[model samples]
Target: MQESWRDEVSLLPEELKEILDITAKHNRWRKYETINLIASENTMSPLATSAYMSDMMHRYAEGKPFKRYYQGTRYVDEIEVRVMKLMGELLRADYVDPRPISGTTANASVFRVLGKCGSKAVIAPVQAGAHVSHTKFGTLGALCIEHIEMPYDPDQMNIDVDHAVKLIEEVKPSFVVLGASVYLFPHPVREIADAAHSVNAKLVYDAAHVLGLITGKRWRNPLDHGADLLTASTHKTFPGPQGGIIATRDGQLYKPISRAVFPYFVSNHHLHRLPALAVTAVEMKHFGEAYADQIVRNARALAEALAAEGFKVLGEHLGYTRSHQVVLDVRKQGGGAKAAQLLEEANIIVNKNLLPYDPPDAIKDPSGLRLGVQEMTRYGMKEDNMKDIARFMRRVLIDGEDPRKIAEEVKAYRREYTKVHYCFDVNTLEDGKLYLLY
Candidate 1:
């Protein structure tokens, strides 16, 4: 295929050639050379990717399955309906809507339903890992929903349950949001759910970062613990395509949120994502438990290794982490910006994040680095490989080695991990050919 692409590009204009060349270079670099620790990112399995590239990409289905505003959507209607069924089974939900295009869109849909102008919604603060969509700076602000932050407990590295409950009762918010972006431990969903319910408010749990673990039974399902709605991204630990899903057992809330997903926020619904998401749902049903277990184990192992390498790993008293993410205080290594840039230079990808104690003004250069093990775990990495990754980071950050040298070592070491695991496909990367860059 590379040879064929080269031949085809030979007859193309310089601009098109340059774009293709840059894309190829990126695929080679990210897919075959770097270690990805970006907590919010993941790659779809080859089977799912193949499904994603179907002819559905060229079509549109503007409304609910079987009731679409467009004709010729019969196949998509069936696929989308089945996808929702699979998701409902995995989520233990009475209703599942796969229409929202992204996690933020799902949140926007629900927030629109429960929150009115001048109404309040209590959420985990930014320091507690609340995604921006839940805050005043994003969706909530745009929709005119008052954003109230639940207090954070730094020692627990989670929401201050008792205080949050009290706040929820006092404020009597329209809803409460749990789950997080930099999540390390499960939120106090049950406790806050009771509080929200007592005040006649809904609880919206954003499982954007932990949906895979929840499905795998490694993490608690918010619905089982009394959450009214759950929103998540398919591409995080879930290992599906880039899309969003909303699930709930609350019949009263489902129809409105479903409508919000359509006429209010999303259209077309990215028809191509449906088949790929369905494929991943099938894969998750077969292998989610083992995959999720390995992801958590790898996260803990990486945290322990990094701590041993002189990094201030967070949540030590809570066993480092119970999810796929590991957080580290990189202030001693020159703050989150320098540390993340250094790691990226060494072919280790990570993102800077604000620690609990960080002031809001610190967004430009927060004190923490957020790392996730889900992507590498999907590539068949285990606890021992995590320790090796730690050593690589230590050499780059602590020992101050030249990043270019580390990059070469990373490339060589990464060559062996080109196959996607926990999916029913006898597929593997040959040379730099079958790459999933996103």
Candidate 2:
């Protein structure tokens, strides 16, 4: 396997080469099947990938295109502006910064802009639906990322913004982060923004997981509801590139935010990737809302289907899920890691995750597994498909417990549904992993 990679590329920066070789081998050569259910993961458009693999990889445009510290940015500037234009239109954002390389970078930029040495940034802890990037581990370098947790309503398993707002007022934080990595329901952005306003703290909507839905209008628009800033990865439910996007709804916040994105924060932004961003934005303008709407449909369907199979699915009373992802507390289904492992053997792909307030041992091998209908849902897999998937899970984790047979059934169903006429050239791949237009 190493030999294959070595043969594929001559430039081997030893350490990176080793990791790349291993990743490729695990993904391509290993006999293990992948039914990746991690909502953060999605299939990129072929054009998006092509844009990433384009000539933009060779340039060193160190500044914003035309204003670069170095020369030869004529085309680079055009591409960057193109990305920015489409991004603003797609997000309905007042100001757009097409710089940050990942969602974490976008959040970091927001933090860096508002957070000083002793500054405070409120966050929902990971157990309470925040991403690791919101934790001490995620904010280690920044020192003094004070925690102002969003209170949860046990009845609904969502943030209690009134209480959270009270905490923000008392703390007088520098920034209030609304949104979560594992949130199973709608976020109270307006209330959160109102709370942050009470304390004069900036409100940042970390829409990393739901950008697709938000853009599609399946979910709330935090900026419209009072959020000052928005942060997200262009991927996830959006089917774009793997990069961060920042948008400010107020003109007053644009310059500082853009400066924060430039010299002070990320310099040498990937110019080549800008075109991919443009392509993604173009795709968004055309199909984003539809893609996002269907993603929610898939989530609700998946949730109901999983519930029917007896797993303790979260967020049913408040009208199930409004996004592409669903959370199932599978501890009753025999533990997340255990179920995920067995499912892998059966050719299904899903990941183990810590449920809200999950125990330490559960974090290690979590009690919950987050599933997404993003890629599969985009393939037009609906409520019925979700049920079939639940049955497969039952067979592997609850009943038959024989993966070979399970894999056979999965393969058959996959062959039938893989032809979901969702995107352009939908069923064009021989390996069955292909699911996008470009």
Candidate 3:
């Protein structure tokens, strides 16, 4: 096998072969070797990824379907329209535009429609898991919108409802944003929506991290709870190609946001993602519930296992977590930076995150590690598997085992899980190794 691989690469130019070698190494490392726990990341199923590669990648569609700014778009136009319908149905939304290109881009389009110079837009505070795009340092700042923060209740690990309502009523901002990159629980959508509406403001929920859970019924749909606009990435929990979507029940707001997506935020909209997005939406329609359930269950199990192994898992009073994420206050283990680096050396991937008590300046190293189970759940990991994962972390971080030795053990264990589950791919296991048959 080594000789054949060398012979195959010998025909290529040195630089090209080097690039291919790097790509192959990364794919093998991240996809098959490592235990990925990044909260904001997920893998698309085989079927969805197969559909993502197409001739549409080379084409352009500047405007909406049928009313395109370029020619040769009849087939793509139909696909785009049906994709929107598929997403709309999954979201239970009357209107959906799968054209923002990214979650932040979707937020930008909506923010542009709702705010202008000197206008205020209230957001869940950073301590409450607000994504950077919702803060003054990101899209809100780019648009010159004043970023007003709602009060966070550390005891509840969520927004302070009464104080947030009072602030909204007083400020009467143009819009309110909810959702987060480090989300673990549901936001107070209904109460905040009521307050925003009372002040003639719109409620925009960024479901970028939990779109799959929402579609699978594992989490509450923000739209059902009164969010005027729902923006999400098709990846993450949704498990599609990377892209953004905006869904809303309000036709009034939808029209302006749709227009903003085309003229202001995105130009091409990445036409190739449409078909894969549609395929994943249909897959979700069929298999999302079981997948999401396993993800949440694995998360809770992992959190418990980590705590049992002597780590400070956060949200213990709130049942650890209701979402796919399990955050740990790793400050006791030399802070999030050192803990995360140690785990990564053991072939366990996770990100250092800011705990609520940490100030914003702590962004570099933070005080917590954010772990997500959606990707591993897609690989068919169950609660027992989560325990093994936690044990691996304990060996690397607590027991002070050599990380290189742990990585070898991790690779051997990871070999048992390879094929993507909850998709149409027919897979089989031979000698404890999974193989896709079709």
Each candidate: RMSD to true structure?
3.2, 5.1, 3.5
Which scores better on TM-score, 1 or 3? Answer: 1
User: What TM-scores do the predictions have?
Assistant: 0.96, 0.87, 0.96
Best model per lDDT: 1
Instruction: Estimate the TM-score for candidate 3.
Output: 0.96
Alpha-carbon lDDT, every model = 0.92, 0.76, 0.90
lDDT of 1 by residue, 42-105 (tens): 8888888888988899898998888989999999999999999999999989899998899999
User: What lDDT would candidate 3 get against the real structure?
Assistant: 0.90
**Two-way TM-score contest, 1 vs 2, winner:** 1
What root-mean-square deviation over C-alphas does model 2 reach?
A: 5.1
Clashes of 3: 0
Per-residue lDDT tens digits of candidate 3, residues 101-199?
A: 899999999999999978999998775689999989999999999999998888888888999999999999999998898888899999999999999
Model 1, runs deviating above 4 Å: 1-8, 427-438
How far off is residue 258 in model 2, in Å? 2.5
TM-score of 1: 0.96
